[model samples]
Target: MAEVKQDQVPQTVGFLEVILTGPRMSGFAGPAWPRTCTIYVAIADEVVAWQTLPFESDSDDFKKWRLGIRVPVASNWPDLSLDIFVERADFLFRRRTNMVVVTREGPHTSGHTAVISRARLRLLDALVLGDMDDEEEEKTMKRRRSEVMEGNPRLLEGTVPFGKAVKLQDWELPAPGDEHGSPRAVVRGRVDVRMNLRPAAFFG
Candidate 1:
């Protein structure tokens, strides 16, 4: 498992620990496998966390790999649900050759959705653990939106490319074990969120 910690912090900040494991490639019948996989974590449909995992073709080393990412949760966070998305970065779809089949029954088929991406959102618990009234919510929303926009102007300009991301509700609880690449298999993962209330020394 890979872990990272924040060092420069005099401000009050919470931590969201996300564990991604048991990634599998299913329903893909192509001769060439995906070269990489990217995971996106979202809150209220806005991306808050993104992690890319590059496949090591040598020895098929990524079959049992596990990734751990930490996201900082600040005060006045918006009230929303937590969502996760996984995309096959190197999925080959646009090709004249019938090299891949979408279904197992078919031998050779083309024109399959080239980019295979799946998503699952865990809404069993309220993502916004903080309590705030309408006025506070409005202030917090504006403040957070400003922060986000300041960090990435493209988001505010609506220049980022987005898709109709899919979300799976039942797959929140994945099956145990090392079934990373099973057909329609959900990745085994969990999220640990902790809240902090210390005062901020300086705004980043």
Candidate 2:
């Protein structure tokens, strides 16, 4: 990979080709689960693209899906970790709890209202590009970043207990569950994804 010049803005950029294939469920098997799946891609905390796949069809070709996304070259390439999430169609925020607790003081009473909103992610993958100049430094930096991102310092305690933690950067949730560690009514399917990087100016 060639290093992009900082002073020059290229007329064209590179395209990140993502091929998601062979998604199958192991423990979950049923028709109640939505046959359609949604894919969300996020880079630098911003959602880049969203795609949906209709996997319920009996056709074999529908099992695989491909996406071509354009990405601009910038100095933050090393910090640009691409995150992908695959979820069922029914995946959305569910209100678990909503209540108000009243506390009385000497002369005044205050009520604290709390609301819980949650969602489940079927599969998640994070891809980080390494520095072409220094491989060792890139590895070290990745490890440190992984450690810091995985640490749950702001986790709260409530009706939803924390489940087994996984690495945020490079990890997959096969059967995503609620905050209480209980799996949702979604089917489980194995997803295979292949990513190919190419310059936008190239056509092959």
Candidate 3:
């Protein structure tokens, strides 16, 4: 893991990509879905980070998800982490002639992992919200809801909890011209942090 100096922190407008994996139910059997997700850059003390919207039918093709976060230059911010959750519902069935039946399938075990950034840590009094400007909050809320209802139930929401400090492992760089062009001299790794999914008060 690379350690960054407090004075040398980069501006918070760079791109961040996140990868998510696990199993999901198909028409019958379950299968593995790997997805690559992206996020537009924004500044926040700590906000939700997801590979993509949770409800899309085609979301399984991605191997990772990208989140765009804007880190404040002057604020003291701690290293970053992730939170995840999954949603499930029950159903009822009818028998052949005149009988009715009901059944419940899940309470599915939704796995949560926190991706921790190994960069230098800063202690901030309060994290800043992203620039909303002319964007209405309702529009953003609708977009987020659509993602959750689409069947893909992995949702990255909630604030990060404090715990034992973890060290980020080193990741091998991709070959030249693979996707990021020639491999630059940058170190990369992610820490998977566990999260609780129950609803809490929103303090915005």
User: Per-residue lDDT for 6-106 in model 1, tens only?
Assistant: 65443444444455544444334321234544666676677776665434423445554555554555543333355665544333444788554344222
The parts of candidate 1 lying over 4 Å away from their true place are 1-13, 28-33, 44-60, 75-78, 89-115, 123-204
Over 1-204, each residue of candidate 3 has an lDDT whose tens digit, in order, gives 998998796544222223333323233322221122122112243444434323343453423433333222221223443323322222233456554333323222223222211222222211112212245743654454455456323322321222122233223457756886553333222223222221212111
- List all candidate RMSDs to the true structure: 16.2, 17.3, 18.7
lDDT of each: 0.41, 0.40, 0.30
For model 3 the local lDDT of residue 66 reads 30
Model 2 Cα lDDT, one tens digit per residue, 1-204: 998796666343444454544443333442121444465666666778876644454555454454556565443343455565554433223356553333332112123321111122221222332222257645654664454467523211110111111221212234455445643333234344444334444553
Candidate 2 stretches greater than 4 Å from native: 1-14, 30-33, 91-188, 199-204
Ranking by lDDT: 1, 2, 3
lDDT of 3: 0.30
**Structural similarity to truth (TM-score) of each candidate:** 0.36, 0.40, 0.22
For model 1 the TM-score comes to: 0.36
Better of 1 and 3 by lDDT: 1
